[model samples]
Target: FKLSLLQIAEVQTQTYLEWKEVHPPQLPKDAVPVFDKKSKQTLYVARLEDCTPCFYDSAKKSCSVSTFHGEFNLGHTVQNRKISFLLNKDNFEIFEWKKSSFGEVPPLPVETCNGYFIARNDFGLGYITDNSLITIGAKKQDTTENEVLTLNHDIKGQHLTITEYQIGSAKASENIAELKHFTASNKNCEAAKQQVKLDQGIDKTVSFLKTRTHTFGGTGETSVSGKVPLIISIGGKLGLKYDYSRLNSKTTSTVEKSLHSVSMEVQVPANHACSIVINSNTFTADVPFTGQLTRVYNNGEARRTLTDGIYSHQEVAEIQALVNPCTPLVDKKRC
Candidate 1:
């Protein structure tokens, strides 16, 4: 006899509730219950059954059924079910078979089931019931030391992967003999040699500045004598010389002088030679050497004097014009 819509729904509901009592819904711990729109209630699938006889395989002891029912006026209808039992075992596990169809199946009463249910239809789309357990052959306890098993589900691809891992007790050691041989075969690369040269330059610069002396020479009847100690500041600037003197043989009198100087900053890198402002008058030729004074101003002088080869006469005039008496040199608008 054909069942009415109301009668069919009632039977489905009754069957669902009965099966739900035996196997409570085993949803994901994070799963929130979804309410059915028609029933205005949250429902879980307890069990699924096929009314028609299923295809059976005696050798495999499995049965499967694929059924299609419904009217075009009512809607599309496709139903598939399969079940397998391990009869030999006392508490035999049951497996549900799913078959795909050309058209969509009518909405079943249960959307989810607590136990394992695997459904595959004619369509590539398939679903695996949550927390399903599948066991083949006899089960045995894992006794191997540090053995681990991992299961991962590919929700998009609808597949499951199982991996096993085990830890080994063997110890690992470096090959000291091979390492020594490899180290002996290696020589200092070009870059390493350059770095060593730079280090030597820096050391030499420090020593040179510490012992540096300045001497003045002129063909005039005056002898410029008396040592001027060269001072190198931490920032690599040449500090001012104080109380410098030029001795004259004719008068036997010494002219005292003090001067302010500006020099360029130099930097050395491991990959390249030292870099310095070569265009500046304070250019120093020695590696790691403090630059020579590009410009010098004698004490009480209004304008500084540029050393030869550093600044042209026009450049010097421009620099002098940029210096304003009313404002600090750094704040001058033209600077």
Candidate 2:
């Protein structure tokens, strides 16, 4: 009986993350304001911790996402199954939510709050594989509705997320490792799960927005992916990866960012459900959504210079679409 969504993503990526598995297009129309174009994709990631790709299970929550692997479903319900955070932030109090503790969730506290760090604890968004500096967002749901989730990461990694569904807090204890104390209701969602756990020391990749699931009955099927870790270019090594040995100084201490695009709008209120899948596009849920999805990977215009370093390239770069995501955002914008 309550669903409010406002997704704003402005990621202008230039480049990383090449682990692929895409397939999400089931539209009967519950919500769709998609804007697609600028197609030229090429991905190929071979190793992300011995190939785990993406898979999550926090007592079986569902909100969809695939990258590196595991945990992040703040929506689903038949009876016992729920999880959520984020209580306020009407525009940069920094987008509210950050009060502390439920089972420990942390990542992104300060990196300018642009956000980009996706892996660890399998629920902490730790590594953020780096797909040419990616940022993708689009959220809309309905299984009835009642969802709430929020994420913000920084340690200089940049990862801000929000998926508002409902239920804000309370109820999600059917063995989520035994609910470390998340039953008392909202404390800024326990401070947004403790800032998603200290902003990534990173363990396995798990952390999200939407909670309610015992077995994805709400259908927000997720395996959370977008690994993309396979970039090698050397010639003098001032560190590694992309360096004709530095012809003009961009430094390179693991430089990745620039080419951003993120737009997330998730809301649930009624029954409850959640789901979010990027790099593979999938936001299908029965219900459970809060709202918030901010992805900003900035390193500055696709950092890769080789004026003469002998040159080398080729892995993935094939997608010449006119506009696809369903392509709808016309008239005033043209998609």
lDDT leader: 2
lDDT of 1 by residue, 71-95 (tens): 1111112234333121111111111
lDDT of 2 by residue, 10-69 (tens): 122211111222222111111111111211221111112233222222223222233221
Q: What is the alpha-carbon lDDT of model 2 when measured against the actual structure?
A: 0.20
Residue 103 CA displacement from its true place in model 2, Å: 38
lDDT of each: 0.19, 0.20
Instruction: Give the Å error, residue 274, model 2.
Output: 53
For each candidate, what TM-score against the reference? 0.13, 0.14
Pairs in clash, predicted candidate 1: 82-97, 99-121, 100-121, 100-122, 101-122, 282-292
Q: Please give the clash total of every predicted structure, in order.
A: 6, 111
Quote the lDDT for 29 in model 1: 22
